[model samples]
Target chain A: MSTAPNRTGAVADGGPGRAPARAARPAPTPARRALRRARTWLPGLLLVSPSILLIGVFVYGMIGWNTNLALSDKHAPIQEGEFVGLANFIALWQEARWPAAVGNAVVFTVVFVGGALFLGWLLGLLLDKGIRGEPVFRTLFLAPMAVSFIATGVVWRWLMNPAPAERATGLNALFVRFNLDFLVNDWWTAPDFGMAAMALPAIWQLAGYIMALFLAGFRGVPEELREAARVDGCSEWGVYRHVVMPQLRPVLLSAVIILGHMSLKVFDLIIAIAGQQIIADVPAVYMWAMVFEVRDPAKGATIASYLLFAVALFVIPYLVWTVRKERSEGR
Target chain B: MSVQSASGRVTAPGGRAAGTTRRGQTVKFVVLLALAVLFLLPMYVLLVTGFKPFAEATAARAWSLPQTWSGEGWAAAWEALSSGLRNSLMVAVPSAVVSAVLGSMNGFVMARWRFPGADTVFTLFLFGMFIPYQAVMIPLQQMLVGAGLMGGLFPLILAHTVYGIPICTLIFRNYYASIPQTLIEAARVDGAGMLRTYASVVLPVSAPAFAVTLIWQFTSAWNDFLFAVFLTGPNSWPVTVQLNNVAGSMVVPYNQQMAAAVLASLPTLVVYLLLGRYFMRGLMAGALKG
Candidate 1:
């Protein structure tokens, strides 16, 4: 129900007699109309002022400040500063470790995103078919999303650590049985398997999130379509492949973009699991090291800027796609 | 709605066929049960291992329960984590409440009133969400240091509040849009000013959305580790950071680590379980619609 207009615009204006009394009113003056518009908007602007102020100062402002820092050499002390004119960027681009870190980041992103999407879709498909105790199972699967990465990282680290033979968990034991201890060697010695090991914890934690998104998408599909496919004697797999998968495209796209963006910025999981000492090259980890561990603000800012550039490469496309999709959907 | 399939079979709405659906439902249940077990494995490992002694946890049978039950690890974790928990709550509660309140107001204005620069402001906020936190970490830290808030809870709170506004505003604004515009119009006609309309009319009607935002912002703030680690000193560290410290200590004890992890995560877990239904519904409503 709507609110009632009152006299002086301060109290209820719509009771049985009030509405009829106001109905036979004269139109407002142009100046009064303008005043009314201003009155309506004034409070809105005031209400939102704090949020706009904070975001403008910290988010946009800091980003601008970071870009400036990237162009300078101020690693020695916070106060001491000198403009490097792309020297840091040049050094970052030519550095052997940076390329390796970039490669590792790319690999981690691809595997985590691809693996989570595949496994999540499979599980979602299974669960969508009128599963028993559906709510219970759904909650169980989605539990990981609720837990902080800090906890997950520690748990996974224990699960992955090779030195502590007494506390060796799943991955460690498997490696021992297979005599694959070399897999845990330093990245400088054997990078491929080390990167894969680093990527596993992220995939484990994130797959469930993808499943939840897919489950929501699966629910949105009309049951009539599935029933019709079944009545036609098409196999269950065939129906999912041809009918259900196509309908889930938007959901998958959104999920991928979100996961991709998260993977690019992933820091806590890697740092918690490997520690900054071991794998010092992944952009986030490297950036964290520079800022916190090394106390090199200029270099840290440079790394951060590059990371932002990388993230923008992915985000711009996703935003464009989402906007286009929203427009098509008449949103 | 009536594009028939190539097989030429007519289907009922929502695909609810009586007998055929029941038979297929049974098969589906079986498959789902197996998947559920797979999903529950890690949780089972975590819960069981938390109760075990260090020795037992270190044993080859890591997935199984302890030979004898003990709550000592949990007690130790509690004792060790109490300080961190206090710090976490101190930062998280304020950050969440402040962000949610301010964000809701921002959202209410943006959604209901078409003001000049509102869209620009909203877009600018949205841009913040896409930028990685790592990208701004250095400058933000330096800024905090320069402001003399370094190594304190203030920086962490400020950073989280800044990061939280974008998503919180997006969620609330979208939800507010679905609210019938007539309510606000009526409030205006009744001589309600902006603040009065928001407090007496808008907010009271948006309880469900507020609850969802509260939980989300709280959990995010509580779960934050990067800022807690980088910005705050030891005294101001959150539970997540404390849990990492427990994990990183020289003589790392698995049971204690597990216990601390469990303890650190319990609040958010409880929040999730209590509001899981509303949380999921709110998320789906926003995600699917927007």
Candidate 2:
């Protein structure tokens, strides 16, 4: 039955049609060839034009509008204000709250991003080694990635309750039970070190994802490379250290980039865990407060722009790299 | 892909089966397994606390299994969140489907029949994937609200789809890129037009990729709190926002909050458990390509 169509089609189209068709040739006139060539782009553009137009207006246009808002002295949406270049920016320098939030973000990003990458890489190393119940362990480790940061924060909030004496709750209670009472401290409120504690839930939420990435990276290293290394008399740890670990640099880079952007723009997790307090404020949390709660739209826009620029610092390079890679690879 | 001994105390594992009995293999597994359990402990607390009555929930040991279990907390959670759950589905499902369709078209075109500036257009769409929602929130809200679309699911659906375009395009483009150009050429060689060729030749093979993109978008939309909080008012609150509200109740609805958290997480959790491989593939694709 399948051969019937092939048999018939082969017999029927056995003419000059095959040659011209293969050549993508047409009426043998330059005008017609030009039209044919031009027609090829129409469907492709027609297919994607809607997305390009909408995304242009929505994402890029919004970003441009946001920058304009940042440059103005507007405090509320739909309100017109004079062009006040860098006024909000100057004000932010004097505002203790903004810089405090920036500090918190820096601290949070360093600890959370570093911790997650290290922990995820370590787990990947273990899982990369052949082990029983591999999928089971993988699933268990990666389960948290499924849940929202909001939910994860809600639970971690309860866990990190900072109480003194025998009345401790959550994790502090465990320290009390085990007589490691010195370890009990106010998490996310522990002054200077609170951001570190505040970063725990974020780490918990993302470490598994980083692990999965690194695990994939680990598995991707061809077995033949490891075998070749072994034949050259490299020990197990030596092989991993010299061969596998070196090859995982890209995975490590990706994890850091992903985690870094996440930490910079972190909002819901902090709000979920600690509410909108200054102690736990990141730039994102502060931006929300300024815009909605404080009703200072100019400051909010400025903060958002700053955060956007900061994130662009981490992201634009990567985007350019992707474009370059794709262009160079010709696909 | 693991090799276990008869007593289940064995060595060697995944990606490479049947290797050696390293000296500390058992110890390593025990530590790794223990860490895995600890990583999962918060959910355990979430479940245990949700099951217990309020009194035990607040006063009893946090880790203990519920002494006296009841569905009261769960009922209260359901009461609080049922409307929000419906809203989440209403917002997420349509947005997911719309984005997937849009992405499929965009991808097929970009991969199969690109023209001058096509890469530039594709790159523009790709940039949307990295724009943190915070950067555009103020103007976005203004734009959406100016058009009388605020305080409802429409704005949220629009926001998610617009934001979703980049990722959806990336995934779909990568998927479509794998299909040989010969297939499309063959379709063209036949009497089929562009849309007909897509419907007949390309769309038929798009099921698995659709599953990947749909699940990714749906889970992301389901888990979103920032957009839901900012764009929509209380009338169209999603489950994540509701969970936060319930957690902040003055009387402290801890048990019900836990239950609500579990309820909120269930959809994506089920997706991850059942189609986890696809989910991971989506994640890897986004990361690797970007």
By summed lDDT, the worst window of 10 consecutive residues in model 1 chain A runs over A1-10
Instruction: Report clash pairs, candidate 1.
Output: A5-A13, A6-A13, A9-B191, A166-B58, A223-B15, A224-B15
Please state what fraction of the native interface contacts candidate 2 reproduces. Answer: 0.58
Binned by DockQ into CAPRI classes (incorrect, acceptable, medium, high), candidate 2 is medium
lDDT of 2 at B105: 91
The alpha-carbon lDDT assigned to residue A289 of candidate 1 equals 71
True contacts kept of each: 0.56, 0.58
lDDT of 1 at A100: 77
Report the lDDT tens digits of candidate 1 across residue range A1-331. Answer: 1111212331222332343454456787778756645655666677788888888888888888888888888885546778889999999878777787788788788888888888778768666643456678778777777788888887777666555434445555655557786543332213456666666767667676677788778778787787688788867677778878899888887787778888888788876777775453588888877776788888888888988888788676666566456546543
Question: Taking the tens digit of each residue's C-alpha lDDT, what string does model 1 give over B1-290?
Answer: 23223212223345433223444555666776776776665566667778987677664767667898778789889988999999999888888888888778887877776467665677677778778887777777777778788876888888888898987787788788777777777765665666777778888878777787778888888888878877888888899988988888858677888888999999988988989976665455334333
Best by TM-score: 2
lDDT (tens digit, per residue) of candidate 2 on A1-331: 1111222122122232443344543335667645555555666677788898989888888889889888998877557877999888888979788889899999999999989988888888888766778789889888898899999988998889887756888888877778899999999888969999988998888888988998888788888888788788887788889998899887777788889888889999998988887798888988888878788778888998998888888787777787767777766
lDDT of each: 0.73, 0.82
Runs with alpha carbons beyond 4 Å of true place in candidate 2:
A1-32, B1-20
**lDDT tens digits by residue: candidate 2, B1-290:** 13323324443443353233544567778989899878978988899999988877764477778889978889999999999999999989999999999999998877776656777787777778877789899888887778887877999999889899888888888898888877876766665556776788899999988988899999999999999888989999999999888886657667888898999999999999999988887887678542
Tell me chain A's TM-score in each of the predictions.
Answer: 0.81, 0.90
Question: How many backbone clashes can be found in candidate 1?
Answer: 6
